[model samples]
Target: MRFDSVPMPTAVQARPRDSRGYPVPAITPWEGAEPQFALTDYGRSADCARGRLCSVCNELMPRGPVWRVVGGTESAAIAEALEAGRPYRNLAPTMEGPGHRACMLYASMVCPYLARPNARRGRTADGESELTSHLVRGTARGGRGAVVGFADYEFAITATQVLFRFLDVVEFLPHADADEHLGDLEAELARRQPR
Candidate 1:
């Protein structure tokens, strides 16, 4: 995928790119000098949520209806609704923070594990993805992740994690297509429908 093709928000544009030219997410942890994509910097994450900052860019959001990439068991219903192109009411506390729609879109397309539906998250020798700031992360629970939007969110900070409760919800929409696979996915979806 051409990294330049990703529609970057202003803050995302300022981020340093990796060897492949993909912008490193603002909250990804740095181990020594390199980024460990598998880990989240909890301090920065909380700050982003608390300060109304974009999770992807780590800068203050300029608008409402924050978008987030939600996955795993908790996001099942929302994911299903999005795939079928319907709206959903979110009554659950969102565990992750807010991000710009464009930043989240860029991430969903550029991150291989996220872009490819069944791609496995690589693990290290000790059964973790990576260890620099290793937290006990769970594998994808057979559900494809979705980019959801919420007008506002309130923090539910605990000693271990930060969560968000979305207010004034919008469609909990999933990806129409991973940008890199647009052509193939469009054809594939069309093939499944009765003509």
Candidate 2:
């Protein structure tokens, strides 16, 4: 199947400044949550640079699908931790930290399942009917209160498929207002096509 390029929708604009009127970075099209693969130390040119595949399950394990959790009341504290490169863990509902006042970025990847056409019900372990794989990305969540931002991508096809499927099932939080932006991107892509 041929893939189409979809420009990110930009319904949400960046904040101008806080009560102090300082400059704030404008939000970009890539700020939304997406699936991503982990990058190895070898960099993109290396074969394994995309990340490692599990031999047991034939799953790709990438570094992320990070969640950036910003502390509503203490945005500065969260920013400081991110800059310092401090490690944090993922705890559903709320991600705790050494400092309750700080924000958090939770990163993780979803597993992929490839179903076999001939697989029969109850024939496999756990009644499994498909092969599973992994996708990774480095996630960072930053904002204030419970509001957060997520950014990710899938470097491998196996991972990408899983992410798309997941999106199909679950509604993305924040419900980005990208209708107009998406319309423009679609038009741009059509213009660029070879025809």
Among the numbered candidates, top TM-score falls to 1
Compose the digit string of candidate 2's lDDT tens values, residues 1-195: 001132311211122333333212121111133212121111221222234332111124344332222222233443444557653222212211110000111010000111111212221111111321111121222222222322332222332221111001011122112121333335534554566
What C-alpha lDDT do the candidate models reach, one value each? Answer: 0.62, 0.22
- Please give the distance, in angstroms, between residue 178's alpha carbon in candidate 2 and its true position after superposition: 15
TM per candidate comes to 0.70, 0.18
* Candidate 2 runs further than 4 Å off: 1-69, 90-92, 95-195
Worst 10 residues of 2 by lDDT: 100-109
Rate residue 149 of model 2 by lDDT. 29
RMSD to the true structure for each prediction, in A, is: 8.2, 19.0
The 10 consecutive residues of candidate 1 with the worst lDDT sum are 124-133
